[model samples]
Target: MTASWTVSQMPDCTDKTVLITGANSGLGFEATKAFASNGATVIMACRSTERGRRAAIEIRDSIADTGATLNVRQCDLASLESIDAFTTGVERDYDRIDILCNNAGVMAIPRQETEDGFEKQLGVNHLGHFALTGKLLDLLLENDSPSRIVTHSSGAHEMGEIDFDDLHRERSYGKWEAYGQSKLANLLFAYELQRRLEAANVTDTLSVACHPGYAATNLQYRGPEEAGSRLRLGLMKAINAIVGQSAAKGSLPLLYAATARDVQGGDYYGPDGVGNMRGGPEQQSSSEASYDRQAAAKLWERSEELTGTTFTFVLD
Candidate 1:
């Protein structure tokens, strides 16, 4: 792994179409800029078209023209209907997608249900992206060159479990616990997707997972602000100022996973700093549970049932 890997090291991506969810702010926004600047056509899939348009304008004005096209499309991952509509539109307009970054996610927030009646964090973070990836799998496989699906996870996954008995936390819910479980689910889904891709002999498609480490992003404030806890929000802001890295630095792992030539199908990338919390991108092992094939398979089956979207791949 290159210890000094930066976005500038990204390979020429002209004509490659990269789709990123939650591209209006934080890591997703930074990644959008990086991919566009490197000559990739970027699609900003935001929940709010207004916010997505604003972000697109900001990128167009801020980034030097690189012949990269930036398009903002409406996509609310919290709703399966919205995901379907967004993907349908994407399929209508584009025949191939070179990269899909499942970067949109909800952090530790108060217990709430999505439009689909699932826990908010799990729904938006894991299941939503799961459905999105499954729906877009064909577009990814259509490209002649290798295409990648980069799912953003976190260090919180280390403390998580499947909790199959209480998958939705309907019986009980803790903010951070649910967040950890969702992130762990991200890893499980990512690894499982890679395995399925391999079994199906799809050599040109890769499913990789990554983490931004402890980057100061609006993600931290969403939970506190949602719960109306000013104290918690303030504390999060302080922590971000003191301990978190810049969003640009934090997004390196995602860029690496998306564009790095050396990346394998199931590789996981994160920060190289102590505790995997900050610094440049580096390949690293995920938690032991993330490698549980049985758990991953079970989660995948349940996800298909919940989302009503089945992956098109036929596994051996």
Candidate 2:
């Protein structure tokens, strides 16, 4: 019988460098805090320096240890320029990134495009991470020990359909639809990356995906706020109170994916409860669409075209 997985089982990560995006709050913050508590050198990458600094301070206080090191870097996923600069600084400072968690994202919202003119949700949630991961691939492979690229997708992917003809929703847009598309794209990118990495005979790098499974966080409010739907927001709040798990509870899957000793590449994890939306972490399968290799490759090609970021690592 499989035993329950818990954060208490997280392996010691002393001196390991773990970088988490959107670490300013919610699940990201919880993940960062847990990593630090377990002795990992944490990089809290956020779009806002003010918020990042504040978050780092809070984690430091919580861990209350002189050995816990937290670095805050400014990276705006909406702008490739910002991502480039941020990676440049990271490469200059750190020789290798043991764990790179693509955890930051934008949820459903008004039809707004990013600085690069892609839909807001797609740009920040998918393309931006695509660019960052491409830039950091070398650093990940450079490490002598095993490395991990953990992508944060969502359960909403079940409702997602990749409309290649309208990835940016240029033809039309619905808030949840856009969010679902991006979330689906996240899984596609993650699984495809793992496949490519394995095909290259590359060892030491594992690409994993995870979802929070109905956790309550600020991410949920983005859509309702953008659409000015008070009733929706109130309903969401009530549902969260009634059924949604805490942010820390929701973060279990991500933390488990990041730190588990037995985790394998391409593994997808989330809540084990009903609908896979509320419970402890467990390895689970994503939607059937997420397994479409042809669609995944197609999405990869489009991502390269749109973001101008290509995975250049040799698959030899």
Candidate 3:
């Protein structure tokens, strides 16, 4: 896991198609920029079309090669309808998908519901990507080349415990707890998907999970800004400046998981330095709870029920 890897070491991505959620900003933007720079047609699936297009334009200008295409499209992970439309467009236009980065997520925001009446963090971070991956499963499996589905997790997963009885946090909800649950679900889903893919004897699509450690990005500020707590926001900014790595550095684990040939299915990667706060991407262990088979199975079923999205693998 520690072979001194970086995005620049990524092999040529000619003819590859990479779809990234939240691609207009932060870590997603870094992912998009790298993939496009390396010749992959990067689809910027963002919630905001205007911002997505603007980012595409900026990235287009930054890259020297004109063959790297950027498609700006709207895909709101908070809304199922938006996700469906986004997938429909991809299916209509693209024949194969080389990589799908489930990178969009919400952090520790106040208790809320998505368009489908699920917890804000769980719905957007886990359920929405869960559904999108399922909807596009066939396209990914059909690809002749190796493909990957990289789910973004966090170190907070160590503190997370799935409460199935109140998964939606209908009875009680804490901001940090909810966020932890969602991030934990990310790993659970990633590992479980890999298991299923292998069991079905599918070799082309690999599902992996990774954490950013501690990165300073706009994501860190959204929660505080939404709560209108300038004090907390200021404190977060100060801490990030002192400790957080740049968004590009934070996105390394994601890119590594997505493109690295050494990466294996079901592998969980993160920073190797102290506290796993910030460092190079490396294979690392996640929380013990993240590896629970029974919980992952139950959560998978629950996710299918909640999202009405069931994965039909291409093992045949």
Candidate 4:
């Protein structure tokens, strides 16, 4: 595929089932619309079922007669119990999942703890998806053909370091630092997952990571809105207008990773623009730290201990 790959280049997704977290808005929502328009059964796993339903209605109204099947289910990544409920429902209703997008995340908000007491950014962005994937592993593995798990990370991961001594940031916390840690954790998990699957000889499943470089989305405004700082919000709007790409454009890397036939596990995709910020999706290398196998192993063990969910695979 060319570096300028677009959704039009995607394979026909008919008869496929895709589960996208945070599907009510941003990249996930755009992905939902794209996949559904191509005749796939799209599950919108959202934190708010009400918002999810409204988003579904909007997609249906806009796309008129694409034979899209969309289902909205509630899944709050900040809460382990909510993920449990969502995954359980999915397991009961769907026998196989062709794609799973671990896309929902919280950005640089004021430091807070999740329902399970993890740092908010690390909790929602990394650990939450980890637990959800473990719980739904059976459905993904059930696919006769290869299934894809596309994780959404960010370029900010380059600035991150896994503070093993203080994973929850109870000692100190800067919002951006926490966000970076979470994003870096995403890559580590994606790569490690692929390694584990390969070690177990599980060829029918692929794990990949992608990022929407500097995409303009609600995520930009969320932190300022949460902080009730209009100044920060206004600055973000200005930055978005001048420097950011459209969410639809930013979402292409994820769409490419999810559906591209040539995609391989452990691959990372991002925009091909200057500094990897804004352009068509292309295969790219993540930070050197993201490939640290030792860090990945430690994080994996800590995550399982914290989330009480362990992924089991018989390794050779």
Candidate 5:
């Protein structure tokens, strides 16, 4: 039987603890609110402490009756040092992490390299999350019941092609192409992680991927120099108005993937509307390339090498 992807149907998460990267705004912010309202302890892992505090306050105010607590911590996904600090802090405080939402990301930014010399988009969107998840694997495994890791992907992954030689985009770069590649990496990592989990007999944890179906979020406006031309900014706003759904609505698929009882490992989800661009939640298939096991395996190796992190769960 097919499962319904509605937030209203989400199982009660009163005792659950969720950590969402990039919880300062947009879909992450809405998701923070959703989980907090359900009585989960929400950790907002953001790059900016100021913004993170504001977001946590806003969420707390919105869900006062639930008595859920929001913790704000600083973590720059583009930097390995920051990732380590964030994980260490979490380890010092929390004993178990029930849900990890790898949702922080940068999109369509100008060609740039992170401090580690990796491309900005790939570093923040994939490798950083890869390292973070690896560091926190012990805490996730400590949970006796099913724990979840939801990696946020995008429909743009359909246009992505992983170029191993130019993974850093040093030779050539286009904003959208690099963004798509990073998003594709997110899905590939999710699937590959699930494979490794099952092979290692780690039945208590699940890894899943999800997309927010053209949500009206700050992710749409980010760029190299913030779109200097009014015409360009106007054009983007026009496109968003024409196609985007509200952030809350767009977060349903992710919420479903993270919390739905019947969801399986490696399931990909998106909106259930025209072109899968803007609507309610539903299970959706990704590109044929995304399902290539060989590519996924290679990507997994490259990710481990790049991030210098390895999973305890070995892939067969």
Candidate 6:
């Protein structure tokens, strides 16, 4: 039988606390709404405090009957300093974190460096979350049941090949290539984190990866102006009109990874439609490189070293 999953199949998140990065818009926003509506305390972590607060208010207005609360916090994923501040604040206020959804990302933007002097894509999409997750590992591990970490990857990761020498594209830069590298890093992080957790016998913490497929999100507009010319943007809109799934639908795979009882560590979730792009949530596979155990291990080591954050749980 084919594996099947949908938002409706998810268990109630009542009394749970989910912290979602970039929860102000797109799939992140929809996921926040879904979790909060199910009675979870939803923390909306956005780069913009204004937008985050507005999103929180919108969720409250829409789900008044659920009696769920939304908390807004500022976190610019491109800045390590900002990430530190955000995590410190969260730790001070929240006793435990039930779920952490690393869903915020940038794609197809011009070559630029983050405040920390790393490539913007790699910094924001992968390293930032890496640092954040490392900092928050204590709270995540404190839970009695499995607390989940869901990294948002992309199907484009199939084309990614990491270049350790030029990870920041100091020699040459291509927007899509950088984006792909970041996404691939996300999958690698998820898989490797699971390995570490298992080796440490921390079965109560699960790490999974997910993709939203081709949903019509603001990420599509990250290209150059000419790249998003009227004709191309119009064509994209036309395609979205015909086949684009709702953001809520796009978020289902993440919800499954975060809450489904049967989901296992390192499992990947995505849409079940053609090319895994436009249907409900289902267990999915990734490129062979994404599953390379050796690479995952090396990447994990490099990530810890580069970010200067070490996990207390050491893999045997």
Clashing pairs in 5: none
Candidate 5, 92-136: lDDT as tens digits:
999999999999899998888888988999999999999999999
Give lDDT per model, in order: 0.94, 0.91, 0.92, 0.94, 0.89, 0.88
Question: Candidate 5: which stretches are off by over 4 Å?
Answer: 1-5, 224-227, 314-316
What is the TM-score of each predicted model, taking all chains together?
0.98, 0.97, 0.98, 0.98, 0.96, 0.94
Best by lDDT: 1
**Candidate 6: which stretches are off by over 4 Å?**
1-4, 225-232, 314-316
In terms of lDDT, model 6 sits at: 0.88
Q: Rank the candidates by lDDT, best first.
A: 1, 4, 3, 2, 5, 6
* Tens digits of lDDT, candidate 1, 87-176: 999999999999999999999999999999999999999999999999998899888888999999999999998889999999999999
For model 2, how does the per-residue alpha-carbon lDDT over 1-316 read when each residue is reduced to its tens digit? Answer: 0336666788898989999999999999999998998899988899999999999888888775737689999999999899999999999999999999999998888899888898989999999999999998988998889999999999999999999988899889998899999999999999999999988888689999999999999888878887899998998888888988899888899998988888999999999999898888889999999999999999999999988888866733
Residue lDDT tens for model 6, 1-316: 0345665666888889999999999999999998987889988899999999989888888875776779999999999899999999999999899999999999888888899888999999999999999999988998776799999999989988788888798998888899899999999999999988988888888999999988887777656443647775677667777878888889888888898888899999898889888887888899999998888888788778878888887422
At residue 121, what lDDT does model 2 achieve?
92
**Candidate 4 TM-score, true structure as reference:** 0.98
Task: Pick out the ten consecutive residues of candidate 3 with the lowest summed lDDT.
Answer: 1-10
Candidate 4 per-residue C-alpha lDDT over 176-262 given as tens digits, one digit per residue, 9 for 90 to 100:
999999999999999999999999899989999999999999999999999999999999999999999888898999999999988
Residue 308, candidate 4: alpha-carbon lDDT = 96
Candidate 3 per-residue lDDT over residues 239-298, each given as its tens digit: 999999999889999988998879899998887778998889999889899999999999
Question: Which pairs clash inside model 6?
Answer: none
The candidate, 1 or 2, that scores higher on TM-score is 1
Pairs of residues clashing in candidate 3: none
How would the candidate models be sorted by TM-score, starting from the highest?
Answer: 1, 4, 3, 2, 5, 6
